[model samples]
Target: MDEPEPERKVNGMKSIFEEEIKKIQDEIDIFKSGSPNHIAIISEPYSRVEHIYNRILGDNSQKINNIQIFNPVKDTDFFSNFYSNQDIIMMQNCQYLFSRKCCGFAILEEFLDILFSSNKMYITGWNKFAWNYLKEISNIESMFQEIITVPELNSKTIMNLIMSDVSDKVTFIDDRVSEDKKFICFEECLIRMPLSNKEVNISEIKFNFNALKRKKNNKTMEDIQKEAFMDITTLAGGKYDVARKIWKKSLKDGEVRLSRIPQPSEVEISDIDELFILGNILAMDGIDFDELSSIVKNDSLLKQKLYNLVNKGLIEDSDRFYKIYPEAVNSVIDELEKNRMVW
Candidate 1:
């Protein structure tokens, strides 16, 4: 018997998640075999590192024990006592251990000392931008025995992930014109001649006959879904959170049209204060007002800069914490790089 659609989608998403978890598990297994080195999992803001960490603990509950999870916020005290019976420690958001100010490394140094001296196994999650900065300024990279960078999801995986969780019936509408629906295209490429050692520009015709046939008739639900998600994935740069945000925006009254996928607005950042504020937010992943104020030093100036950023739709404030908007992560990163604020 054929599997139900929801069940099939669940299984597909599970397979993709398992594939990602397996890579981390393999590295963990090596550490479990009496390796002295601890593990570090790093990824960009809004990536799947935290989700994977939780899944690992949940899935291995029977086999893995004596584990404690710690999620630290700004000005967190790392000197707190650990459970004596706990054999493994998992620390999330280690970026909050330090600020971007003078004497910022004090807490980080203390934490590293505890980490290095402890006999228990350690697992840490870090913001990728923060990790890079820390690596450049300090010897933090050498401390981790194994480092795992979370992989980005492809268009197919993103589609499966989004669809699997959707219980409501969603209709995918293909609103593209005939020209936009073309399944064949011509492209020019440079090829080197083997004997002459010279390159020649050649035009090549590429065809997707199956897609063409579908276009002539009615497109299958699967084909329409793939095309919509492909556009979403490209716009999201394969980040799950960004893709999901796009999905939610595209959906209206249980219908998702191809033309409804939101495009990222242009971000303009010229002020030096705005650049610094954005850099701090990106590096810390998510930070509260006080912590950010500590980095910026001037409370009044910081408030105005953050307000401007929020108005620009480049970042959002939740409670007291500020984070880059899911869709604007790439744009913010590009702006920071242009200003040489981030490496």
Candidate 2:
């Protein structure tokens, strides 16, 4: 993990921002024409949020000509210096301005109010998980006139997006399956708990028994790579960054193997404190270790839990900032909801 992540320098790789540029063009034009429209762009993490923001500034034909792009990640005073001459404000990575304070309701209330009232068009980016949490607690979604999400890609789209990054570098040598495979018995697989009327826990997990049949489909080497690429994309929930990580992990001996595909490491949660920390981290999208340590009542215990979470692969840290993996976002959200850490 000490290795610094190299910049994504793959050739022929389509920028995630390219497809959505024209989709929001009309709205951007409308905003420029004095129509009050605050556009909110939300996406999962590792979705290249910065890249998208740059693309907006770089794409000349989008019609919002000669607008100063303001990234508030470092300059908290950027908004304070706003003048009427500036018609558009690009607020990138707004999550950094927020924390777990007051369940994050108190984070952007005043600034959002200002943006809504002013004639200026505010284009903002946010992590979907954090955005949803804010919408629930602060009713912030209503403030935005228009919201667009970076699309969750399928196998075909993922191939078109990132295939060039791996093509010609590695050849498909063999086909492999999951690391462990066994026929699951219906009775054993069915999970049940008593209804609320009774003193019991009732949880039923239904499996598609019919979908278990393995079909006979012969594929060429190129087709198999496409299939593997799609599988990784699906497993990673079409997150381009996470899909690339899984792809690189699965490649061995200059070949791709089905079994090498990765999943979030499962951790046994006996303590409720760990869940609390994780929920807040998800709510903020990411938090610095120092800031988190200050927030937790017990610094030593928080450090221990953070180490455990990192070792278990439920979360990863970079330069003391920690964030959940894209594939695990849903599961983390589920855990938070189940624990009543979030409403």
Best by TM-score: 1
Candidate 1 residue runs with Cα over 4 Å from true position: 1-20, 27-35, 62-77, 177-219
| C-alpha lDDT values of all predictions | 0.76, 0.65
lDDT tens per residue, model 2, 154-218? 77767676655655666664346542233343332333445634344445445543335333344
In angstroms, how far off is 72's CA in candidate 2? Answer: 9.6
Candidate 1: TM-score?
0.79
Clashes of each: 0, 1
TM-score of each: 0.79, 0.73
* Candidate 1 per-residue lDDT over residues 1-343, each given as its tens digit: 2222322123334444565567657765665533456778888887655467656665544333322323333343434544445566667777877777988888788888877887767778888889988988899978887888777889998887888889999998987645545587888999999989899999999886767776578878778899999999878877888888889999999989998886655667889999988998998887888888777889999999999999998889998789999989988887888888887
The TM-score of predicted model 2 comes to 0.73
Q: Highest lDDT: give the candidate number.
A: 1
Worst 10 residues of 2 by lDDT: 1-10
